[model samples]
Target: MDFNQLKQELFDYCEEINVQKVGIASTDTFDTLKQRLVTQQAFNYQSGFEKGTVEERTTPTKLLPKAQSIISIALAYPSKMKDAPKSKKGDRRGIFARASWGKDYHDVLREKLNLIGEFLEEKVEGAQFKAMVDTGELHDRAVAERAGIGFVGKNCNLITDEYGSWVYLGELITNIPFEPDEPIEEGCGDCNICVDKCPTGALVQGGQLNASRCIAYQTLTKDFLPDEYRTKIGNRIYGCDTCQVVCPKNKGVDFHLHPEMEPDPELAKPKLEPLLTISNREFKEQFGYMSGSWRGKKPIQRNAIIALAHYKEVESVDTLIHLMKKDPRPVIRGTAAWAIGKIGREDAKQVLEKAKLHEQDEDVLVEIDKGLDFLKVHTTT
Candidate 1:
């Protein structure tokens, strides 16, 4: 079969599989992306979730010896929930970002890529294709941009004309010499809303991100969150969407293209109180399918404690006190003690004082002291 005919066939199959967009790119080295990676490394700006070395990420042939083209695919997800439940006062809820709203996109994208590989295998005899999603060495946004699927927006997300930046990206490298699509020259122009509205100012002038300062990256960390971002994260338990939410390109773009991408109102915005006490088995059963649960329950529970404190919910103080006194993990214990202080219920000082005497961990002791310090002059409610 000719290259154009194969591409047309592949596009048809992509439509059948519900892939929102598909584009072809050449196997040229990503020179601009390499320079940016070098700068990011020099400045200590990487989120540490990045995989592989710089060369492995930028050079396509390194991953596939006879690589002639790359196939990029995008799947659109919902930006708003249908009957989204609100996070009320006593029955407060913590939110998972839209990316983690449904079944893990990594699994969804990988499954689709594998199916594409099967389609190509049937069409091109003895064709070799290697597929990957977000966890892959090759930057999905860079590949998608080169493939003409989208332009990398100032938020550093691949923004498609149809789906905005609300699409999950994946790609496969193939030996088939398919015609490459022209990269979009359309730009963000003077629109700086995403950069200006980053909650923690993680977005630099031209889309470079200091991942260390990003709340989205901070949410996945297992340690006690930094003091600066505690209030900034608000009720976000998994990731932050401030950048995307503020972008003009993303306005009025809420696509429910895939059933698996739909958010379950309960799991996506679970009651903060129940999450604080969710057992390992229960947590896995309830949230294992969601991408946000990859770091396990520790960070989510800690964030839940912080969200409760954010509301100054006196009712949650009892749960926080239990976590402070009994939770084995120092991160959980320390964070809970801090939350108890922030809540400042009627018995706050007394409870913190009791825990201070018995806490063995120096870190936990420090947090307990911090809690007591909150009650220095002002009386508790």
Candidate 2:
């Protein structure tokens, strides 16, 4: 059987299926990635979300025993939202990053990968394949890079010429000995825009990231956010795009190729006050379709509180006070207490004093004290 001809056929099928980019790579152990992972682990720079051991992550053969080649696919998502709603003074809103704008990419990419796997099975008598999206043990970016889908940028994102960094990546590991494509020669040379502009300095160096300091990572944490990042997170509820948004390579790189990836203006940038009080059922009904909702409503609600504080949304003072006193979650109650203080309403001291009397949680009391301190500083002046 002519594997080269079969490779071309697979490529054609990918194009017909509307996959934006496709490339083939040999199933060689990723030595450099293994080293980097080890170093990242030692320095505590790794995000705990990573799946599998370092060996399973870097060695394709471990994922699929007889893996001979890997096929990488990328689908471009829209970077620019059309007719986005404005975050007016009284009705301020928070944004989900561009990656989370549309329907979840996991479901979309999984469907595409399954299609490719079926196609390969039909063509080859005994084609064995394992497909993976972002959650798989194998690093999607490493596989994509080796497959020549794109070069890894300083922001640690895979940047393709056709779609820049605004793309969802997936891969299929198969026993077919498809010829590997050459890695892209392009790289971010002396361009430090993403590094310089990272809100939390998550990008330690060009290609390394301290996920702990990353606003994207911080936004997903269930606990109360640290004091320093409460203001720095701005109005982002899920994920941070400062590094990607500022990259020159991504300039004018919006793509609307996939209908499922189109953003709904109101949902992607919903009003902050409503989010603070959104019931779990309502939160699910409104945001369940989006990828950013994976962490559920708590983190998003927490970020919403921080965003209201960032704007000093005086209109939300009443809602903040309600959350401070009535919310069941300690994190929410504490975050609301802090935000109320930050907003500094004329009666903030009174409300906080009342909350202080009944608050049982030690952490909530600490936040209430901080709120009173803010009032104390303002009242004396």
Candidate 3:
């Protein structure tokens, strides 16, 4: 069995399946990543979405006992959408980050990884494999960087020469000892755009992120968004792309190789007002296929309220009031209360006062009071 020939064949197979790039890495423990993770934990910088302990994350052998090599794959997604609808006055919209533009990338990448696994199974008897995507314990960026798939940029994204950072990464830890590829030695080279432009200063420095402060992470939380980020989140309902959008490396690097990764403009930038009152089943039927919907509709709805506030969409004020009065969830009710305050129309104070009399939740009451505060100066003028 010639391992070198098999490696070439794997590359060919990846091309046949439309996977943008592929590389091989050894099963050695990621010592550097383990130390960085320690710092991230000490600073409470983690997004709380990470799976597995530090040991399990760094040691591929822990995931697959006999793991001899790891194969890293990249699938480039479009950075720009064609015929995207614009967000206008009465019909304001919330934007989903490019990653959520198409079908859930997790499903797409997993299918590709499974195809790779089956191909190897056919070639090597008893070839064990453990596949991983973004959700997997092992850091996809770390694995991809080590595998020569790309270099880790200042934004902590694996950046390939062909695709910039607009790539979805996945890996397969296998017992096959494929020859390892050379790690890319490139870097961001003194570019501080992403860090400098991070909305909430989530990028503590280049490559270091305080996930709790990141708009993207904040958008996924099931609670009220911090007040400081309401304006910064702008129209973004799912993820923040300020870091990637500002990075010079990503300029003009959009790739539309996979049709499955293309954006449906309507879904990617859906009307924010409709999102406020969307039923769970309706949300599932419309957006469940997108990766951004993984957190379900609550966060999206909350962010939509925030986006309405960002735009001060006066037309949605009544709808916001309905949610404040009728929604069962405190987070949604409280968020809508906050949005009403932020939008401070002439009748807002009267509307909020009426809701305040019926509100039971202490937290919701606090938000209602905040809403009334915004109305004091608003109504007087």
Candidate 4:
């Protein structure tokens, strides 16, 4: 079959498999991508992506030339569990968004895309193809946008008329050319709710996300919460979803069609008190398959302590006291002190003072003193 006939067959097959948006592009696509990455200031691309940095390493492989066409796909994943907990003080349980609560999407999407790649090779004459989930060097989101899959939102996420911004993207670069699809128009006209609500001001301007200041990046990337951002972090212990949650366009979207996107029961709304006490083995066992679990248990545990501090519940004071003296990580100890201070417990000052005398680390000692000061102010009232 000729290129047009092959393109029609490819489109029909993808539609049969529920894949959204497919396109073709040359190997020179990378040149345009490199320039776009430079304009976006994603990172200094001169060295060809950092060893393990997400910005550098997020997309792992590039397809070699002789692949004349690039086919991209997007799968919607919009399962709503519940709203953020309302208590300003208490356990303040938080659930993972449906998209992130299950096994990583990369593994799932790559497996499916590889199957499609195998099919293409078997059917086409002397055909060759490479598939990628979000794990490829190609700009899958940008390509999907250009292919009329969706428009890019002010949150810097792809938003589809059918799925809003709740779809996962994957692609297949093949040695057959096909007609390229037209891009959708931008849907986020005059709406800046996402920018206004960002606690860290991560959205600098029209749909731009500053990774350095993003809370999602802060919670997942940094070994410990920076002191300057701790107070503003609120209760997000893993990744932040505030921007997606508040988007006006996301309303009334039905998630019932995507049963696979449903969140795990344990993660739907985990109790922080129990979460704070988990052993390393338990942490791994519970979250081993999850995206948040890849960073290991320490960062999440530290953020949990910080969340408890922000809640300032009297019930959390005992938990804070226990963590301060016994937790293995200094970051956790520091957050525990901060939590104790937040709770305004009578014993907070005494416990911090005792910890201060024994605390050799200057940073932990400073946090202890801050806890002590908070307690002093509360008791004098």
Candidate 5:
């Protein structure tokens, strides 16, 4: 069987299917990644969202027996939103990271990977394959790097020359012995923009990331954000894109290839005040299709409250009071209390005092105290 010809055909098929970039790599244990992951765990730097053990993540053979090769694919997403709504004084809007600007990437990439798998099955009888997107056991970026799709940038993103870092990556493990493509030999060199500009110093040194401190990871957490990062999160309702936005490699690298990947201006940059009281059904209806909504409305709502505080939007004060008093979730209630304090409106002290009288949750009470403290300082000055 002429495997080289088959590889060429596969590449053509990928192009026809609108896959932006594709590359192949021999299945090999990722020694460097394993060591880094182990060290990250030791330092408590992991985001806790990682799916599997370090061994399971680095060894492809463990996922699919007789895995001879891996095929990596990238789909470019739009960096800049078209006709983005302005965040006015009373009606401030929060930004969703560019990665979540459109429809969920996992669904889009999975469809492409399934199509590739079907193509492989037709070409070779008894062909076996396993496909994975971002959430899969195998680290998609590591697989993409080994497959010669792109070089792993200092920002820890797969930086392709064609689309820059504004791309979603996925991979397929297969028994087919396709000729491996040469790995990209590029490096970030002396540029330290991403690391230097990281809000919370999540990027330790260069390529290493302390996910716990990453605003992208922090935005997805269900608990109250750490005090240090609360102000740092800024107006981001979902993920943080500081590192990627600062990368010199990503300059002028916006692509609107897939229609499904286009952003809805209102949803991607929704008004902060409206989000505070958005019903569960409404939240799902508007944001369910985006990748950022995977963690559900709690985290997003919590972040919205923080965004209102960041803007000091006094118009949102009434809604914040309602959330602090009436919200069933303690995290939301506590976050609202904190945001109310951070905003420090004239009536905030009175509202917090009323809620404090009945607030049962210890965490909520702590946040209420914080609100009162803000009022105390405001009164003194």
Candidate 6:
């Protein structure tokens, strides 16, 4: 069968199996785009990289030699609870939809991709397949666009007719060079809502992101945040999705029922008090498999403290004080100091003084001052 015939058959199979959208493209497309990603200043350099590894660069072809064509798929996970729920108000939670709240998409997508790979091998004669759910070195967004799934929006998310920007993507690489899929026409048009809505001015240009300024990266990727960007990071515990949430195209999509995507309730509308209270063992049990678990409890815990600080929610002050004094993780202690500043309580002042005396790290001391400043302002007010 020709490429078109094969692509049509694949799309049909996806619909039959309850998959939302599937698109195909040649492997060479990713090779070209990978080079482009490296040259762009918008890319955030990964923490550990001396030379060439997956961190430095990625090559899909190296993993799947027969990967002549790639099949990309998208699954939507829209929120069941409308308007992002008000668990911890004043902490924006930064618009992360249900899609990102559960187990990492890498694991979820890989399971589905592998299932599809097995099915393809059975249906198509002499077809050999391998799959990657962000593990292999492929430019997934570019592949999704090539497959006609959606256009790359100004927010850098793959936007689809059915799910808007609320979908997750995964791809399977195959040696069977089936018919190539047609690329969709770019749909961003003259709209720039994503750029305007970004709080940190992270969107450097059309479809470009400065990783340093991005709230998602700031909260999740950076181990130590520079003071200048600390206030801008907001209260996002993990990833940020403000760009997609405000996009005009993402209106009226139902993503709660996708076969492969569902939000874990704890993550969807997390309780800041409970999150702050969770023990390390419980933390591991609850989030060890989820997307943000790789960073462990420190970053997320720090974020919760920041959220409390941002809101001046003095309720968590005791929790913050405990974290400041006893938490072995210095990052958490430092952030707790910042939260103390936000709470601006006289009690917090005492804690901050003790933290200042005991703190050896220069960075942590700076955070103590920030907390003290908040108290100063509170006293003056």
Which structure among the candidates has the greatest lDDT? 2
Model 2, 198-259: lDDT tens digits are: 99889999999999999999999999899889879999999999999999999999989999
> In model 2, what are the clashing residue pairs, if there are any?
none
The lDDT for every candidate, in the order shown, is: 0.92, 0.93, 0.92, 0.70, 0.91, 0.72
Candidate 5 weakest lDDT stretch, 10 residues? 271-280
Q: After superposition, how far is residue 334 of candidate 5 from its true place, in Å?
A: 1.6
Residue 169 C-alpha lDDT in model 2 = 97
Better of 2 and 6 by TM-score: 2
Superior candidate under TM-score, 4 versus 5 = 5
Which digits, one per residue and each the tens of the lDDT, describe model 4 over residues 1-381? 677887788778877766654555434444444554565565422223223333332232344456655677887775465453344445466445455766677776776687677767777878877776664666676667766788778887788887777778887777676676767876899999999998888887756667778777787753557777788777676777778778887877645444555567656556677778988899878777776676787777777777777777678778778888888678888878877886777777778888888778777877887777877788789
lDDT of 5 at 339: 87
> Candidate 6: deviation at residue 229, Å?
3.5
Off by over 4 Å in 3: 379-381
Q: Supply candidate 6's per-residue lDDT for 229.
A: 57
Instruction: Please write out the lDDT profile of model 5 over residues 306-350, one tens digit for every residue.
Output: 989999889888888888989999989998998898889988888
Model 2 scores worst on lDDT over the 10 consecutive residues at 370-379
CA deviation > 4 Å runs, candidate 5: none
| Minimal lDDT window, size 10, model 1 | 372-381
TM-scores of the models, in the order given? 0.98, 0.99, 0.98, 0.87, 0.98, 0.87
Per-residue C-alpha lDDT of model 6 across residues 300-333, encoded as one tens digit per residue: 7677667666667767788788877887777877
Per-candidate clash tally? 0, 0, 0, 0, 0, 3
lDDT of 3 at 79: 97
Better of 3 and 6 by lDDT: 3
Query: Relative to the unseen true structure, what is the C-alpha lDDT of residue 344 in candidate 5, on a scale of 0 to 100?
Result: 93
Please give the TM-score that candidate 2 achieves against the real structure: 0.99
What is the Cα-based TM-score of model 3?
0.98
User: How good is model 5 by TM-score?
Assistant: 0.98
For residues 1-381, write the lDDT of model 1, one tens digit per residue: 688998999999999999999999889999999999999999999999999999999999999999999999999999999998988878999899999989999999999999999988888898999898999999999999999999998899989999999999999999999999999987789999889999888997657999999999999999889889997989999999888898888999999989998999999999999999999999999999999999999999989998998988888888888899889999999999988888888899889998988989998898888777777745633
